[model samples]
Target: MSNQTSYDVVVVGAGNAALCAAISACEEGAKVLVLEKGPEHKRGGNSFFTDGAIRVAYHNLKDIRKVVPDLTDEDAAAVVMPDYHEDDYYEDIMRVTKGESQPELAKQLVNRSFETLVWMKGHGVKFELNYENQSYEKDGKRQFWGGLPVKTENKGIGLMEQLFTRAQELGIDIWYEAAAVELMKKEENICGVAVEQDGKRMTVETTGVILACGSLEANKTFRSEQLGDEWEAAIVRGTEYNTGDGISMATAIGAEKFGEYSGCHSIGTDYNAPKVGDFNKPGDIYKKHSYPLSIMLNKDGKRFVDEGADFRNYTYAKYGREILKQPDHVAYQIYDSQVRPLLRKEYDLEEATYYKGESLLELVNQLPVDKQQFLKTIEEYNDAVQGGEYNPTEKDGKKTTGLTPEKTNWALKIENGPFYAYPVTCGITFSFGGLHVNSSGEVLKKDNKPLSGLFAAGEMVGGIFYHNYPGGSGLMSGAVYGKLAGSAAARYVLGNKKDTKITN
Candidate 1:
């Protein structure tokens, strides 16, 4: 702690979340300072890696009927993830979390979700607003599944660029490449943060402190302890900078955590791009695979996950245990069609030529195992749909929620010859485990009291929703919670509440 350091509020972490908090705090007439651990104006942390989207309904119950307009509690309750109910969403969350969540906070996250998104959009963050499924087309051809915009051109790049630029415009003091070492707290109330920059240690102090420092997936200890022995095998799917320094500091300060039993998000082992070693080559980069046209196999002539389904849905279901159970604990994504043209015009090979089958049989012929086994794999899959089998025995092999047992969706038949395939493991954009928070975006103790002079937002806070991912919810939460945290901090500065403690 430096005697010379002082401000009205100090924000740690310069990602979208921190930027949002700083922008909001500055708007609230608070003298604010922002500390970011990565390169300034560059995509360093998870915010840049984020496929930026935000999901919300409303954070305030009173405003709930207004955001949706004519939505009652029952209707609000009914609108949930397509595959699940809101209550079920909550229960599944607590169960996977092993009851580590704070119930009060969870309720608030779901309720106030919509309002947060609107607030962000009002901030000049253009949200994808069509109501149907469409690709990256800017013509408003399709709205996303849940009737929101894709909200990202490669996640948070445009949006993050805007927020960072806007924060600077607002004159919020920003210190880039500043990594926070510890929290500055007085009797459990956060006051500021201690960060190091350019080999110089500095104490950035404030009356109010916000920890939007992001997730802890980069932290090896948390990964090993929470994920299990094979934790290190799970390569980072996105941002490698968010190592959970803020979370560790919070834990040290007696802030309770939830969702420790299992991960909030599944980490996958699939390599995002062509790299040295392993199985496939440059040709495998984003190449299309035709089943029955191609043969699928693991390192040991086996199939692991269903290759036909949407790759993201596949990633969502790749549990950590399943990745560790394979040969070399790795699987192969084999495909045919010699050149699909990854075709990067920027650098290196624009086309990848990894797995190619002259013909489906020619590719299968190269395999060591009985060709019948690979053929049967495709035959059985096609059979289940044709035979009207309510439950398909397996999707490629593993039974995740990929293609439901409903049996209606069999998009492409595998009979097309000259098949192609490639190997891909599991990976994710970010880990979902974070500090339990309520709809108000207030960080809570296990006992449900808001810590005075302290608030959290972004990947650092929790309890918005689980399993049922609302697209853009992460950015939405960051904006929503950060805004609320700033407003709440302003109230604290104005001497509004004597007790930050509230019991639900």
Candidate 2:
């Protein structure tokens, strides 16, 4: 711990959002300090474990080239990366949330997404096309699906390292293993945070505070209370340090709660995945998104949800919750040689939890399910599959005809020899509940009044996500709100009445 007792802005957490805030505050001429709950190796909350794909509104190839200038003419010709307009972005949010997301917050997220990506680029953050996760090539053309097209270079861990390096270059001090325990409030005004580091505790005074520590995904108690009892057995897909410290601390100090407390960004992960994410491997490998291209069977060998109801990006987050409702919270994604090549890169990892068999019956024999029931289920599904042109890039509507839970798209038969099945369990990413904040990123009270000296961003700022989330939007939301919060906090500390926007 430093002898220094104060800074102009104090940022809790050291992930993408906290780094963005710290960088923004420092750029605005404020002395900023970042407190990370984990050690140096495990610093970047959930953001570290992600692929760092950002879904931003872009008009054309020219707009994308601005962020990734290295994009060559050949590259543009090889891929079908369509322009995602602002309205399209907004509609995705509203449609996914069923109009439950706050309008103002959604507008801010959509409108400011591109600008935030540009800002990060100008600040030395590199971006590249997410070839592995976002697109699948067919007929000599790479067609991108899911509206998300770009990702940080080297993915999440790379993004965090770049941000941390930039913060250090700008003289922003970061204290690793410094877990913030409480928010220090002076009457109704926030002032500083009390953090514990190296078995010692100290209070660091600050003119403004930014809470970007993350959610309660790793906290079993919080999950049991808010999500459901079934979530107690869910695996954590991110950092173990995000146990709702920021949310709890702010809520204790009059911060209003908002959004779907019962909702979260969960996904189907390898059943044998460790309780916490492995820093060495990151998190993408633990994910089993290939279910979209397979037939997901419960323990009874009965199909539950429609595996191809939508694009994998659109439905993957919510399917984990559905998996939790299954018997023993277990599900198996069955596929054959015909569909094997269509599986995502994550499914091919050496550490992936899967089994291979020469036939469907052979595969079910390996799985913990009734062999007859499993065979019957596959026979019925195979019979229902209608012959259609198989297209992975778009919704081809190649579907099943008369199944109770129809595969609405990407329907492929499992008749090919050498079948594969992956056992999966639910893995909670982050909760969609936390402190409420305005467009300017000022934390609001239960009465809708702004809390002085306090602001929030990232997963800790609610109202943007509800029942489900769009893929790649999480990182964009964090950056957008983090910049706004940092600039707002800096203005408050500088005694500036006018709100200034932070831009490159």
Residue-level lDDT tens digits of model 2 in 114-195 = 9999999989999998888888877797888789989999889889989988998998988989988999888878878898
lDDT on C-alpha atoms for all candidate structures: 0.54, 0.90
- Model 1: per-residue lDDT, tens digit, 292-336? 122235555555544334223222333434544565555444432
* Consecutive 10-residue window with the lowest summed lDDT within model 2: 495-504
Once fitted onto the true fold, the runs of candidate 2 whose alpha carbons sit more than 4 angstroms away are 496-504
Candidate 1, superposed: residue stretches over 4 Å from native: 1-4, 41-44, 56-107, 129-148, 267-297, 301-321, 332-354, 364-375, 387-408, 464-471, 496-504
Best by lDDT: 2
TM-scores across all candidates? Answer: 0.72, 0.97
